[model samples]
Target: MKKLFFLSVLLFGIFSFSQTLSSTLNKTTLALGEPAVLKINIENLQGKDVKSAPKNELLPFHLEETKDEIIKKQNNYTREIEFAVFEEGKFQIPALDFKIGENTYKTIPYEIEVINTAKKGDKISDIMNNKEVKLGLKDYWQLYKFYVLGAIALIALFIIIYYFIRYSKREKNTPKVISNKTLKDLELLKKKKYIENGNYRLFYVELLEITRNFISTQYRIPANVLLTDDLIDFMKQNNTISQENEKVVEDIFLRGDLVKFAKTFPDKETMGADFNDIKDFVKRSSKDIEFENIRSDV
Candidate 1:
């Protein structure tokens, strides 16, 4: 009786540990393109320490397999299969074979529905048309804006440089003042009637300006800013003027200063002689200057 009872218990335990598999779905019905996760649970593998199992390569109809996550325990394994269904219909997922060790397990079939949300029941809606993006100035500017701006900037820079060169050449060809031009200036000053009006101070002032302008241009000196004595000293130091010219300059400068500052008035005869003396000096100095505008004083 003890042996028979032990045999019955062993058979019952073997029956209790039989292979089992079940399939479930996270969603029953879903919109087209939506995901449906199907889970498969397996238990009680026949071989405890088996080496490997056959690969089950079959997938459900009309369902795209997105992912398959498997969880393995001591005696069971669970698989979560994520799928995206595009076709609109009811689908019965057929039973799949799961070969674990030596024994094969089967999962119960599942049913899921997929619907098209773009249309109502039995009424087809107009599908969206393809759109063509029209390109405008702003869009084209975004593509080539750097090259356009750089070209404009370069052109402006070249224009500025060109004008600057032209201006420089013009200035280089022209002189501000020249000794030969003093004759024309002196003639204009004489036309002012400064001496005839008994304005000896004004006359001397105008005459001295013409003299200074001539000296500054001819000798490349800032004679307009120099005192009369300083000017004479600089000329003497540099031996730029002859003795006769120096004497004439000293006499005219000293007398001109007296007339301007001390209110000393000169007669018409002395003024005329002083004016002729200045003309003589200019004529004598410009003889060898190779000036373009100088005319012989008859």
Candidate 2:
């Protein structure tokens, strides 16, 4: 009776101790040069700090420590380590040793299979001599030379006729230059009573978009998508807009942003001043258009 009781107590202690440390592999199979994870979970650490295992070069694996997390409720500590296998074979990860409060414990070893992705004993030379194929127009050219020439000539004639028709239609339908379009759009926008109707937001939005579109068309700077500062930077970098004219454009954009985003209302005088400034900017920037207008009038 006394021996039976002692054996039961001893077995229980061993079982509890065995449950304290455990290790697992995320995947047992891997391809060469691919990484796998090794998880070491230690329970009932009792607030003792633990140190990771030292890397061993003799093993068939390369080990790297990735993460260590602590679970306060369960008194558990988890260490995540990464392992990469370079050689293709079946191997076992050696037991990883951990130290806690002058006591050393080791995790169970895990077996893994590393597969080779490359073909064995295969070389470019092995395939180079196995097959030979000849391809060219020379072999069939003599038999169908006249037919081929006729087809090519027809294709050439069709292309010439197609381009001639396209050119004639384009000449008849080509719209006026961008400057003329911008001027007409501005004139139409000015006819709207957006400011008088308390639609300052709409007024500024249209104003800014029109100016940005003009800049995009004239300078090709994509000003429509760029903010005021970015537009200024682009212009400065390219030296496209003169410094004085750049300040005028910046002022207009700033006021427009305030009206559009901040809901600020500007007086009629201010609106009129900005409107004239835009017109002046367009005229000065598009000298070629102004010259053409002058020539047409003369």
Candidate 3:
């Protein structure tokens, strides 16, 4: 009977020692990319409680807080340490040592292995069943002809708008100023009396140069290249002169050339007539002139 009692007490002490320092893992084999839960359970069965688990350095994997559960009857505290290993490999969990009062308890080390997924022929696994997505029938596809037509229309519209703006600006900047001289000035120019002075050639040259200079200053056109015919044609094309004005201009040019190059002397009255034609031309075109205030010498 005494031997039996001793055996019972020894067995109870061994069971209590096993409970004091122990660790366990919840899974035996974990797949790659899956979580494996390792739990280290330590029981403070001694008379005093020390600090919680010792501070650890930067670990290979992540760890979480330790959880505590109390057993009132045993006057014991259990600390549950949880950790996860996310890769596929054999991993060893180090032993955890705890100091209670002057006594120290150490837990046994543990290890685990993670497995990889199986391969199949072009068929996705059951884990990725919901990842296959399909396109709907309502998506839009623009045709090449539609794009080309739109581009050409846009280009044509731009060209038309550009030319319209350019021409409007050209018309606005076009010179409208002709001679702004008074009728009295024209009459005075006619009465210069070149034929009476017997200088018909000088008279024709001065008259032609003055007319060209006036046109040059008024219309901003270079007078050097313009022949009498070209000037008449331009005036007609631009509707600058009436038909009567053009007829008078032609007669003046003919008489001026006869006296200037042909050396045919004109009578004073014929000279006066040509001069009067110039005066009338200036008068008729005066209203068409756009006046600009010329800057004067200070």
For residues 97-212, write the lDDT of model 3, one tens digit per residue.
66666667666666767767756566654864466656454332233556778899999999999999999877654443235443444555557766678677877787777766
| lDDT values for all models | 0.77, 0.75, 0.61
Q: TM-score order of candidates, best first?
A: 2, 1, 3
Q: Would you list the clashing residue pairs of candidate 1?
A: none
**Per-residue C-alpha lDDT of model 2 across residues 106-165, encoded as one tens digit per residue:** 888878888988798775456455667675788688779999999999999999999999
Tens-place lDDT digits, model 1, residues 1-298? 9999999999999877876677888898989999988888777754453222232234655788888777777777778788888889998888777776676667777788888878545775569867899999999999999999999999999999999999987665344435448888999989999878877888999999999988777655578999999988887886555566667777898899999886677898899889988887777664333332342232
lDDT of 1: 0.77
Q: Judged by lDDT relative to the true structure, which candidate is superior, 1 or 2? A: 1
- Reference-based TM-score of each model: 0.39, 0.39, 0.33
Q: Give candidate 1's error at residue 3 in angstroms.
A: 99
Question: Which model is ahead, 2 or 3, in terms of lDDT?
Answer: 2
Model 3 regions lying over 4 Å from their true place: 1-192, 288-298
Q: Model 3 RMSD to the real structure?
A: 18.3
